[model samples]
Target: MSLPSPSPFPPPSPSAAFRPPRLLALAGPTAAGKTDASLALAREFDAEIVSVDSALVYRGMDIGTAKPTAQQLAAVPHHLVDIRDPAQPYSAAEFVADATIRVAQIQARGRLALLVGGTMLYFKALFDGLDEMPAADPDVRARLEREAADRGWPALHAELAAVDPRTAARLAPHDSQRIQRALEVYRSAGRPLSEFQQGRPGRGLRPAALLSLEPGNRGWLHERIARRFDAMLQAGFLDEVRALRARGDLHPGLPSMRCVGYRQAWEALDAGWTPAMLRERGIAATRQLAKRQLTWLRSMERRTVACDGPDPVGDLLQAAREVLR
Candidate 1:
C-alpha cells in the first residue's frame, strides 16, 4: 500500500464521462438553403463550420459562389473559405487531408464540427477516401489541355467515353477536371480510371451524421435556381466577374473561372451576348448543377435525414438530436 501510495495522478475518469467525436455533415443541392440551416445547427450545437463547397475556397469569388457574408462569418467561425486563389489548384484529396485535420482540431477544443456545402464530391471524398491513382503529369496534362482548347472539351469527353465509358457516363462533358484527369490516368497507367476504382471501397473518414436537403418538387427546385441566378444578377454578378477579369491572371480554362455562373458570365462577356441571354444561360447551368447534386444524393448508401419540406432547419435539428443521442 505504501509503495502504491502518493501516485502523482488521480484515478482515471469513468468511461461514461467521455463523448466520442461526432461530425455533422449538412449536404444539399445549391440554393437549397444549406447555408442557413447549417448556421442554425452550428449555433445550437456550439459547432464550427467547415465549408464543403469547391468554389467557396477561392478568393474574390463571393457573389457567384454565394460565399457567406462577413456578418455570418463573425457569428459562427468557418474554416476553409477563401483559402485559395482563383488560379490555384485544389483537389478532393487535399480537401480530405485538410478537413480531417480541422475536424480533429475542433474536437480537441471541445467543439463539434459541421461540414456544410453543396459539393457532393468533396463530401464523398471526405467520407470515402480516394483510390490510388497515377500522379499528375504536366506534359500529359498540357497535351490534353491543348487538345481541349483546339477540339473542345466535348470532343475530349467523347474520347474518354470510348476508353472508359463507366466513368465518362457519370461525368458531364463540360466537367473538364474529371475529363482531363481520367484521360491523364489512362495515358500514364495504361488502364481506365474506373478500373482502379472498381470493387475497391474507400477507407473513408469514419462515421458521420449525414443530412441532405432536396426539394420535393422538381419544378420548385428549378424555380429556386432561376430566382437565385436572378438575385445574383441583381447583386451585380457581372461586376464581380469583371473584377476578376480585370485581374488579368484569371482565365476561362482555370478551375475558378469555370465555376457555373462565372463561366457563363465570361462566355457572355466575350461573345457580347445580351444580359437576358446571359441570365438564361446562368440559370440553366445552375439547374444542371442541382440535377447532378441530386443524382449524387440519390446514390448514397447510408441512411440520411432527407429534408424536402419548407422547414429544413427544423428537420436538420431533429435528426441531429436523434443521431447524437
Candidate 2:
C-alpha cells in the first residue's frame, strides 16, 4: 500500500505553551458524546472536522453509525464521510493517506483539524506512522486457503502462534482473515507480522492536545451503551439493515456488514430472530466494541475527561482551552 509523505509543516506539540492548536483528537467510546464535544471545539477554534471512524466512510450507513445529522454536518465542513460504497473496503492505510491530505488542506486554510471518533486504529495509523510490511501474495494466499480448507483456520492459527505469538494471542482461533494475513506475511517475507507492527509506530502528528473521554466507572458507560442501542432500535435500525439486505450485494463477511449493529441485524434477518434476541445481541456486541476501544485509548498519551459526568462537553471545553490557547 502507498503511504502519505511526511507533512511539510510541523504540527504543534502537546507539551508546548499557549498558542493556537493546529489539530485536536476528541476520541471516546461509542455514545460517549464525542459529537457535541468535537463540534464545540471545532467552532471555538475555527476548525474543520476529519472523522476518525471506520463505519462513517460508507454511504448508506448513517443511522447505524450515529453519523452527524444534516444540521450537524451543515454546521461545519467535514471530510472523510460518505466517501466509499458499503461494498468497498477502506483500510487503515487508506485512512492515513486520506487524513494526511485533509489535515494539510484544513491547516492551509488556517483551520484546525478536529478529528473525532472511536476508530482507534485509524487514529493510531494517522498520528503514529505505519510500519512497512509485505504486500499480499495471491499464490501464498491461495496456498494458505487450501491449507485452511484441509486443516481448518485454528490449525493454521496454531502455525501462526509458532511464528508470531503476539499476533496469534490477540486473534481468536477462528479469526480466519487476520490469521491468513499474519501467516501470509510470515511465509512471503520470512519475517513475522509482529516484527513489522513493532518496528515503527510512525511519525507523530503532534496535536495541541489529545483528549480521551472515558468514565471513571465502567458501569456508567455500559448503561449508556445499552440505552443507545435501544434508541437505535426505536429509530429504525432494523429497517435500515433491511434496506441494505434488499440490495443483495452485501454479505455478513464484508467489513461494513460486520460493524456492531449491522452484524447482529444481518444475522437476525437471515435467521428470523425475534426483536428481543436482536436487541440483546446488538447491545452485547456494542458493549464489547466499547471495551476494546477503551483499551486502545489507554495506550496513547492523552488528557482524560470523565464523559460519564453531567457536564462532559463543558469539561472537555475546559481541558481543550487549557492547551489550545
Candidate 3:
C-alpha cells in the first residue's frame, strides 16, 4: 500500500541552543489506526519507527499480528519488529533495553524516533522503568503452573485478584505467563507486584509525546474488530497457524502462541472448530485484547489526545504535531 504523503506541518524547531531527546509514542487498541498514523507522522518528521508491539516482534506471524506489509516496512524503517522466533520469549524489560538503544541511535543521527504499537506494558516500561523486582523463582513458577494446570487460569486469577487486585485487574484471566510471573513475584518477594512499582523513577529514556486513539463508539470498534479478523481469515490466517504448529518446536503455551488470534486458532484447530466458530472466537478474542489495551491506556498517568472520528490518523497526527511544537 502506498503511504500517505507527509503532513503539511514542519518538523519541531529546536527550542534552545541545546535540544533534549524527544520521541513520539502512538498507542491505542487494535484496529484503532495507529499504524497508518505513525507512518504519516514518521514521514513528516523523517523518523524511524520502533514497534512496541509484543506479537509483532515474532517472525512468521505476520497477518495475525497485523504487521505492516513489506511495502510499508520498506517505505519506513521500523525497529524491533520480527526480531525473534516463535519459540523464544520476549518481555517488557527487553523492549525497554532495545528501544532505548534504537532511540539513542536515531537521536545521534538527529532523526526522530517514533514508537508505535498497542503494547502498553512496553510503553510503561520505557517511560517509568521497571522496578528491581525479585528474580524468577523456578519453584514458585512450577507451583503456580501446576495450580493453573489443575484449577484453571481463571481460578488462579481470582486468587491473584484477592492478593494483588491492582495487577490482576490489568491482566486477563487467560494471561498465564503474566499471572504466573505476578504470583511468582509476590511469592518470592513477599510484596505484591503492584507494590513494587510504587514511586520508582523513570530510567531517563528520552522524553516522548504520547497519543492514544480510542473509538468514540464501542459498536464501531467491535465492527472493525470483526471485519479485521474476517480479512485475516481471507488472508489465510489459519494456514499460518497450521504452519507454526507443524514446526514441532513451537507450542500453544509459548508467549508467541498466546497472542490473541494465534492462541484461539491453536485451540480451535485442536478442538475441530468450524470455520464459523473460528471466526467468531477470533473476533471475540481481538475485542478482548482491544479492551485490555484500552484499559491500560486509560491507566497511564501521561495525558493523551482522544482519537474519536472517522479519520483517527488525521486527528492523532494533528495532536502529536502540537506536542512536537
Separately for all candidates shown, the number of backbone clashes (residues 3 or more apart, or on different chains) is 0, 2, 0
Best by TM-score: 3
When summed lDDT is taken over every stretch of 10 residues in candidate 2, the lowest stretch is: 1-10
Per-prediction TM-score, please?
0.89, 0.85, 0.90
Candidate 2 overall lDDT versus native: 0.82
Residue 214 shift from truth in candidate 1, angstroms:
2.0
Task: Assess candidate 1 and give its lDDT.
Answer: 0.81
lDDT of each: 0.81, 0.82, 0.82
Candidate 3 residue 319 C-alpha distance from true site, Å: 1.6
Q: Mind giving the per-residue lDDT tens digits that candidate 1 earns over 1-325? A: 0011121212234883366446777788898888889889898889999899999999989999988899998899999999999989788778888899998898888888998888887887777677767878989999999999999999999999999998888789988877998999999999998776543234565444567776667887787778888888999999999999999988887878888999999999999999999998899888888888888876764435555566767877877776565
Q: Tens digits of per-residue lDDT for model 3 on 252-298? A: 76889989999999999999999999998889889988999988887
Stretches of model 3 off by over 4 angstroms after superposition:
1-21, 137-139, 198-202, 206-208
Clashes of 1: 0
Model 1: CA > 4 A from native: 1-21, 195-202
- Candidate 1 backbone collisions, by pair: none
